[model samples]
Target: MKGHRGSILDIAVVADGQNVISSGQDGTARLWDSAQGACIAVVDDSYSPINAIAVAEVGNAVNLGSPKETPSNREVGTEGKLVVLAREDKSLEGVSLHSRQSVFDFEGSDAFNCCTFISSVGVLAGGLDGNIIHVDITNPKSAVETVSWSETPVLSLVPFRDTYVASYGNGTCYIPLKGSEQVLQLTGPNRQPVFQVAAWKKLVYTCCRDGFIRKYEIPDLG
Candidate 1:
């Protein structure tokens, strides 16, 4: 729990709420005991700073191909989930929760700033170059597809039903429809960068640099 040489970028609690996983700018992904504040395992070390982490219950959808890096010990158990790390090296890493084994390490168009699980078999990462890279976990080595609307860095990726709501450094919030490829912008009071997004029922909310939380009504996304 104390190994990161740089700032810890993100931390995710397990479904059981007893454990947490963290990614840091120090280039290590660590597992920790939430209650005891003990380090359980060092999940991976890429020698490159990690920017974000997301936990998803992937089950059998992950390919679990040849591990690129495996944990040194087995004290941390696998939890029928995978830990995805967004790294500054332009790579996205997936490691099994319990086994602490590498599931995959995928490089993207630019350093990834954020990532999220789109489905059981699919993952999405947004990069500094404004590209949203999609990965099929079951066929991870295949050519990855990208989506971009501008040249500004992507700051966040939030899953919303069948599509994803992404935010950019240029203060734009985009909701890209899955099939239609239609992009809808959520207008705010100003152009200050939208940092993150959350949705409840048919309403979408975004936090911005303008020191305001903006809300948008999505009548059809319910």
Candidate 2:
């Protein structure tokens, strides 16, 4: 189900698998019905092109598991919050999907390219100015400077387990949760731009601008 005429910057499927949300270079974010492939809602933000989109389950903090329960026996519940990030006016803006309203807007000196939600830690943003900023959603007004990698414009960011995997034009860098040093760097094909990265099971996958999706086995950093 595809109807976007302009370039699709980013797309995300809802947790329920009933709808798909897409952000485009046309300065709009659209929610579409997955079954019929029809546009249901259009969020107009003409600040800049919406470069990335992320949907997360938000709800009251609760732990529903017993000590005797095994890893596979845990039950996952729903969180009500959905976070959407956009590249606006050389910065990043975040909004809530439930209210379809702006939650908070962050302005930086450089152009913000991408962002991702890291479970309970915070929101991580990568900038074209070679900086990675972490924002605590619990405190909407604070900008926490987590780590920085100079001379590289981080184009994509994906969180896996407790670490974050970011990609640039030169290669990909893996940042551990507790270490300041880079854990790993996997070079892309011939310096192609890494557009997106995803982590599933025990493997990490990268989609490059060269039109190839490559998968790598995630190493055990023990």
lDDT of 1 at 95: 86
Number of colliding residue pairs in model 1: 2
Residue 89 CA error for candidate 1 (Å)? 0.6
Q: What is the lDDT of residue 10 in candidate 2?
A: 85
Give lDDT tens digits, candidate 2, residues 1-222: 455557888887776766677888777777777766777666445647888877676553222112232221111121255555657456566555544566567776576788888875378888887677787666656687646655578888888877778887666555564564646766556777787788886788888878889988876754
Off by over 4 Å in 2: 1-5, 60-79, 177-182, 210-212
Candidate 1: tens digits of C-alpha lDDT, residues 174-209: 998656768888887366888888887678899999
* Per-prediction backbone clash count: 2, 3
Q: What is the lDDT of residue 148 in candidate 2?
A: 67
lDDT of 2: 0.67
Error of 2 at 38 (Å): 1.4
